[model samples]
Target: MKLQLAIDLEDIQGAIDLIQKTKDSIDIFEYGTPLVINFGLEGLKKIRAEFPDITLLADLKIMDVASYEVNQAFVYGADITTILGVAEDQSIKDAVKAAHEAGKELLVDMIGVQDIATRAREIDAFGADYIGTHTGYDLQALGQDPGGIKLTAAEEIKSANPDLLIIGGAISTVDDPATAAAEFKKLLG
Candidate 1:
């Protein structure tokens, strides 16, 4: 089990500042979709260069051209890159191959997937380093709680493949992020 902090705000410096403040406690740092969209790949590079020891995940949420995008993410210093679960099978396979070849890891984001358990089982068998149940920002703003969804998905994935690392996102909205993160970390344990 690992505690991954997702940085989704607009400012790169603000994200960096927060990471610096909590660097010692978190297990992984995610350059969230908003941050990547705001600052490009440079956002990943800047933070990774500053904290060489922390594992960095770039939430590109790739849907196509997996190999090229995943490769580029690794080149930009991402230890892990994500792809959408709804993407074509070939794309997911390509992403996994690229990640493995680069000695990196791939996370399949099960965001819009209707059958998360089924897809998680398939992705785990296909060798994705992690299977994540992610709730989009819009969904979070609608007052949907991701904690229950995350736990349900984690339990489903754990039963299917205990070896696959399970990640839960959409936690930044929680009133007490520290307690929320700690509770999520315990899900895998």
Candidate 2:
């Protein structure tokens, strides 16, 4: 199986440094949502320039302006772009058209969709190259797994949505739960 590393919680340089280190082992390097949102497509431009031949996936989570966004991602060197499953069916179709026209792939991210089975079946008909899911923290609500979130993700998430009610999992699962909670508190509170 090919390993696709989703690189989030890192700035553009950090992501590039990571790809530089892991390129040999990873099949597809994903510039995740937070990274793209923080650094813009310039991150893609820089990474693509640095690794000209690597398979780069930009996790755009495109919910609107589907065709334009897909084309833009390709122009910036994304081998694959993403569309949200919750988006309108026509938007998904537009994205597929854009990807096919550019000889690239569109991955449909069913991150927050309610009906996974129905959406997956519908998206399968749209010819998306792949259908996938990401762990949406709020949706999953830490559910009892306490270590999947890293400090860095916490900080970025907090920064993006300051008023968001922060939750913790790693802290609860760690040997020193109090210490972990304190650290998150320091970073987020």
- TM-score against truth, every candidate: 0.79, 0.75
Model 1 shows how many backbone clashes? 0
Q: Which pairs clash in the backbone of model 1? A: none
Per-residue lDDT over 1-189 for candidate 2, one digit per residue giving the tens place of the 0 to 100 score:
244566777788877766665555456778888888899998899999999999999989999999999999999999999999999999999999999999999999888888889999999999998887555766456573333557767656566553322232454344554455556556665
lDDT for each candidate structure: 0.79, 0.77
lDDT, candidate 2, equals 0.77
Worst 10 residues of 2 by lDDT: 163-172
Across residues 2-102, which tens digit of lDDT does each residue of candidate 1 receive? 66777776487867776675555568888988888889999789888888888899999999999999999999989999999999989999999999999
Which runs of model 2 end up more than 4 angstroms from their true locations? 144-189
The per-prediction tally of clashing pairs is: 0, 2
